[model samples]
Target: MKLKNQHIEEFLQSGLLDRYVIGDTSDTENTMVEDMINQHSEVQLAYDKLQEELFLYANTNAITPPDYLKEQVLNKVTPRKELEPEYSKHENWLSIAAVIVALLALSGLGYLYQQNTGLKQEIVETTTQFENLERDYELNDTQKRILEMRLAFIEAGDTEKYLMRGYIEEEPLRVIAYYNQPAGKAQIEIAALPELEKGLDYQLWADVDGEMVSLAVLNDLKPKTISAEILKKASDLNITIEKAGGSKHASVENLVSSIPLNTIP
Candidate 1:
């Protein structure tokens, strides 16, 4: 029994267990290995261990073959020769079935990969739409705040509107002013004003006690604001064209327009 046990251990380590699990053993060798598995506990355990390892390897390394390769593999598969009566038909059937199931699983993996890729694209598109909606919401919120402020200014009791026109009729310059005397605040609208030549800008002045005080230097034609205490005592508003940036003192000869605030009442 000791010698027989040694033979069995030697057989287990001879790499026959690997060949048997992958269906590479001959009919005679197959019979011998099965008899050893039924008769010896060690042989059976080694065979079972080989089967488990093979299954784990197949699961870990399986891949989806391309369509043409799938057809080629199917065409290459042929039935094995009929073994003698002593060979187990049940074992052959299990091997063939395992092959079929593995092929089907590889095809299923291809489908699952496509589904995963499509889901990733949809996630990207949904993220872009959400970002665009957030930007639009922010723009609408800004416009809402601007409209509310404009409405408040219109409703104030001390607010006055003044229109100042250019002295030279051919130049055709104009501006509108919304002035609040109590708050000493004013908003100047220059939308109708002509575009300035290059290297020139419009400068505003408040005529206080015969002196022209600098209020603001205009860059673009956008609306301007004057929020100074000096506006409360100003008798008139003036605009003049100055060099780039502006001048320290108004060029009285270049006065474009002037409106008398004291005569407005």
Candidate 2:
């Protein structure tokens, strides 16, 4: 199994298992974890143990003190004979100590409550920040990869580059394309685009002779590396506004721009 004792320890210590129990994991991960529990005896045992601990914690009674705690409290509250010993000379002192302990316990509980609330808020803020950082990192990494591919395509010395105009011009589109038909690769650099309305997106089409073939429908039009196969049979490239995903046929009336692919530079 990929999971081991260290994994269990981490889950137990880092509170991941608590998140899992509460359905905080993503759907993909939740499904995978359930599968592991079903497939692996070790995983099942660990998971069961966690569940049992939670069940005991939730159902345990509040009024009854444990024997050690009961003994400690009784020691403080019990009245001793006055002439017994110097140790037993505490008449009002034990009572005072008991009250002080109770007050301190209550104060500690309040302090802990405030601390827990503060920690929860910090956790939420940290989670959101982490998600944003992760997204930015992914976008930057993807852009870097696209740029590298574009450079390689250019260096290969066989390309048909086009300006495509209109800030890439697909009716709310923005892309700078490096198309290499021989290598079957297309690299696009996205600059800017008008914000798309809900349920609408920009689509790219390859115009082959007279037929328009659906190439790609872009919603998150990040710099992309696309297959050049679509361009191989294409004599022209066209961009248009389309429904969110794509259409079987091109929306020519909605065409924002067209670039001839084979024009000699």
Candidate 3:
């Protein structure tokens, strides 16, 4: 009932109307075409036009047998002494007209099927495109927020940048921290940290006057914010490999990276 112009055009061009008018369609096709004709005004109009054309063609090409041929048919029937009657020219013409109408109906039905199929495909494609666009928008929004936060950190005054690397040459770990001592604000970027084995976690600690205090545990790549209380009297920031869920006391023997904070201006 609700059809697009382009879809209607496609249906009309598919030549199904011609097939139906000529009685060359299946039962299923007949049902579909009938439904379309009932629901879609465009389809019904097209079907009407096609039938008119076929009728005109049939009339223009109709042939009338001569009188001699009719006599010969009647004579043959009489000689056989059979009571079977000979068919009249008008009767033959009627049969031809009926066949033409059946074909037209079949063709129309086929066209309807094609039109319905096309619409279904269009709907699926449209839905997929919408989903893709939505996903892209969300990703862009998240990136925009991150960029804004990074810019704010850079513009803030009295902020110190600290790059914390691995203690050993073979340990490929790099973490960046921006600390605003005056404002008691801090953010950490875990840029490059190798995946730890199962049942182990990377834990951060603040070394305050030779005593280590747990800061936060690293389990994901998301940005981490250090609490102001942990940075208040911290002299150094340290990372250590600890068991799953981290430890209350720092594992001194598992220290991986440490950066002295006393040099901050």
> Best by TM-score, which number?
3
Model 2: C-alpha RMSD to truth? 25.1
Scored by Cα lDDT, where does model 2 land? Answer: 0.67
Q: TM-score of every model? A: 0.55, 0.47, 0.56
Per-residue C-alpha lDDT of model 3 across residues 100-125, encoded as one tens digit per residue: 45444545555676788999999999
How much does each candidate deviate from the true structure in C-alpha RMSD? 15.2, 25.1, 17.0
lDDT of 3: 0.74
Residue-pair clash count for candidate 3: 13
Pick by TM-score: 2 or 3, better one? 3
Model 2: per-residue Cα lDDT over 78-141, one tens digit each: 6666556633543334344444445445556766887999999999999999999999999999
* Descending-TM-score candidate ranking: 3, 1, 2
Flag regions of model 2 displaced more than 4 Å.
1-146, 154-156, 167-174, 195-199, 263-265
Clashing pairs in 1: none
Best by lDDT: 1
Candidate 3: Cα lDDT at 34: 66
Assess each prediction's global lDDT (C-alpha) against the native.
0.76, 0.67, 0.74
Candidate number with the higher lDDT (1 or 3): 1
Give stretches of model 1 more than 4 Å off. 1-115, 167-171, 263-265
